[model samples]
Target: MSATATTTVTATDSPRKGRSGARPLHLPGGISLRVERRALAVGVLLTAAALALAVVLIGTGDFPIAPWDVVQTLLGNGTPANDFIVNDLRLPRVLVALLVGAALGMAGGVFQSVSRNPLGSPDLLGFGYGSAVGALVVIILFKGGATEVAVGALAGGLLAGVAVYLLAYKQGIQGYRLVLVGIGASAILIAVIQYLITKAQMIEATRAMVWLTGSLAGRDWAQVWPLLAVCAVLFPLVLGQGRALRMMEMGDDAAHAVGVRVERTRMLLMLAAILLTTAASAAAGPISFVALAAPQLARRLTRSPGGNLLTGALMGSVLLMVSDLASQRAFGADQLPVGVVTGLVGGIYLLWLLVTERRAGRI
Candidate 1:
């Protein structure tokens, strides 16, 4: 009977022999990746879709350029009017949306995978509020410039993450404890933001409110370069830890038994997530729920287990671009902030998540 059970388990674990041949690519430090053809196909399709949507957005704005003109302008060939509209006016906003969305999505994926909870995103876990508080201080009290606001946001997010980690650390960190602490920290930070807004002068208050709502209205290369630099440095670091993160989902003991340094890996991933969230928030003022919803959305689209970082990043880019387009075109001439649209949509997604989790007995 034992032998029969062993045989059954082995057969179940083995990959099918004939369907889509498996390609095993070995890496340094004994890491390996199983490349699936179907996954590759899905990735290509998603990328194409995202690019198509971006083109549509660039060509459909107020000073609308033709799609052909947009493509030519992107390639440095269109007439000056087309060039001005696509290259100068529309392109930067689209780029910022893509980069920020990707950063937030990747951050969400890391946090969710590390905590082994769907509610473990930066927005839900307090990092976004923390960054917002930092930026608010610069905007209201100091009347600082854009660079200063970005730096303050980064500092605030890092500080918030450390505080929550220390407070949640008991014998060891647990998902539920970290989440609870983060939510509390987030609330406190939000209250601080509200107070600061109230004390500012009318003009400053209006600016603060718009920034808090996460607009990409006048975003230019100034916003784009900083976020691009941060994502370039941090995304690779996060992707490298994907294997260890997957191991961690099986519990610390199991991960440790598999030669993973559980605590160290979690700390590193958490730091990366915080930095990603900070950079994105600094650029776009906590664009609500891209971090919260992007990873799970990607997971469903790919039907893959674990983080699905690449797909998550793509989905985030698509979601933000679509939202920005909707905000500009949906309500006639009174252009809304991208954050407003996301906030409305994300609120619904949050409610549905809660209901679903409750039904599954995981809430």
Candidate 2:
């Protein structure tokens, strides 16, 4: 049975009025949402920034279309050459980056919220490596096509998630235990990936290496559509669970007293997070630390508690698009994979997190 069936709200006093710039939106069945004005403004700004970066990426590639022409082409009013560059050549990769980043950001937010730990990201939790192993197996052993690789990645991620959950489950799940177990699992999976690479032929090994580096160089519409569809479906489902997730953050006993099925909700949320991670990994080859960094960055930007899914998604889109641009343009005539930039940045952030957490006596 679902928790919502028995969910009931009891108020001992009158509802407090909202603060300035916070509006109360009443919903069906007496539920209400207090929308924050500042957060909304931040989301809008981040979205515009993401769009601006997208335009820059589309216009500044090898062929170099004008920004105005990129805009006009998007609106169906540009020259055929510009249209081909913007729509056919560049836009698909940019879109893939945007969508993959958003998916990772949301997945990170979900895991972080559930674990109540800043380090509980897909990359840290072995899910990314698990997906990598699956993709590598398909690429090296089976010589599978793109769609088969995607399916393999998804299966690998889900299996990894389940393994972590079961290994961490003693009397329910503990955040630290889950993290530790996940790290161990991730180490094992990475060893497997290394062995697989060592055994592959030169051409297959090179292809696997490039994919594992997480490049957006040759992505096209085929990569974009399936990821877009997955994000479109899964994002809303996760967002809908935001309230329950927030409730769970108050601790299991407290949340249970208020009609939340803590275990079930956590399981569902973990499943959703794994699916989102799987989708992004399948599309972008486990681009590291966007998941770890984006949600934390978005929370800082919004100054809000809980997941801040909207801001996180927007921030992720901006981070990845900017990273992709830097990877391509930072070195003269030497294009780098997008993952290289994120890995370097995310490593610094992780070190900072470790020091901060240690200082706070939370690790």
Candidate 3:
């Protein structure tokens, strides 16, 4: 091989941990574990920031409780009134917001990695629109409640992912092809959603529109518990596949040459991402831009290339919570949907991203 070709091959074959500046720790039986310090540091800092924000968010509003009281109430130690407001009233909403953000962020990491595209996300891949279609069908046609709507959204997202996969599967699912097919599916599903909206009764249409905008208002333990359960199962599943995902970013042929089971890894990651997207959508109504922006933001924060699932998830949680706070207080008692805040911010971020990518000749 030519010198340059040989050099490229060597770099592509290098251990990813080394590229990330990961450190090794000695262990029993002559074993060792590698940890990426930057990702770890970023994760810890984001966790602290997210928790602090959560506490402050929980403490705000009429009949305000102190941060300490919010903490205590969360720990099951607060008095009845504080508990009523914190636990019964607010905690679930905040928790849902955090979980929804985390789920979407991690899912974004998965999709972006699989597609090798910065714009690859549930928001653009038709899953969100599919969830919306399912949800609108339930809300407008069947007159379903929150729980039913969540179930429908989940079903819709999964079906959308499958359809996108099937359409993109020609010649074994190329990265760009998957993204293009997914975006096309999203556009079509959006039209379906609009049609459903036109068919709804006035009251149902109002509620459906609000749900479409994605609010945390009236969220309770019901939303929290199911979403938490999904996150518990899916977070580790997706993170376990992160290394293989980063490998796939090197290209499928190279990854397959390394015994990475490229197609299997891609399929598993896609399924996991789809489920996470649906779960977040089910919980929070496909709150915009968190899926699109969180992973990218987390990677930049860590000074990493991309696909740090944990950091991305933490960053996602933080973004959603911050947006939730802004939505509640940014206006004077208007109490907008959390989706509105994220949508506005995400829109601006999207424009900046496009311009930045254009400058870099990547768009």
Write the residue-wise lDDT of candidate 2 on 1-363 in tens digits. Answer: 001111211101113324425555677898665666666677889989999999999997678877888899999998988888888989999999999999998888888888889999999899999899999999999999888988989888989999999998888887888889989999999999999999999988998998888878889999899999988888777777776777777788877997888898889889988998988899889899999999898887766677777678788888899999999899878888999999988899999989999999998
lDDT of 2 at 4: 14
In angstroms, how far off is 330's CA in candidate 3? Answer: 1.2
- Cα displacement (angstroms), candidate 1, residue 225, comes to 1.2
Tell me the tens digit of each residue's lDDT in model 1 across 259-306. Answer: 988899888889888899889888888898998898898777555567
Worst 10 residues of 1 by lDDT: 1-10
Encode model 3's per-residue lDDT on 1-363: one tens digit a residue: 000011110112246757666666567777544556676678789999899989988998877889998889999999999989998888888899889999998898889878888889888889999999999999999999888999999999999999999999976778799889988998899899889889889999998899899889889999999999999998777766665666677888877886788888789889989999999999889799998898899878766654877788888999999998898788977888999999999999999999999999987
Rank order by TM-score, top first? 3, 2, 1
RMSD to truth, every model: 5.7, 4.0, 5.0
Q: What is the C-alpha lDDT of each candidate?
A: 0.81, 0.83, 0.83
TM-scores of the models, in the order given: 0.91, 0.93, 0.93
In model 1, residue pairs whose N, Cα or C atoms come closer than 3 Å (at least 3 residues apart or on different chains), thus clashing, are none
- Give the clash count for model 3: 0
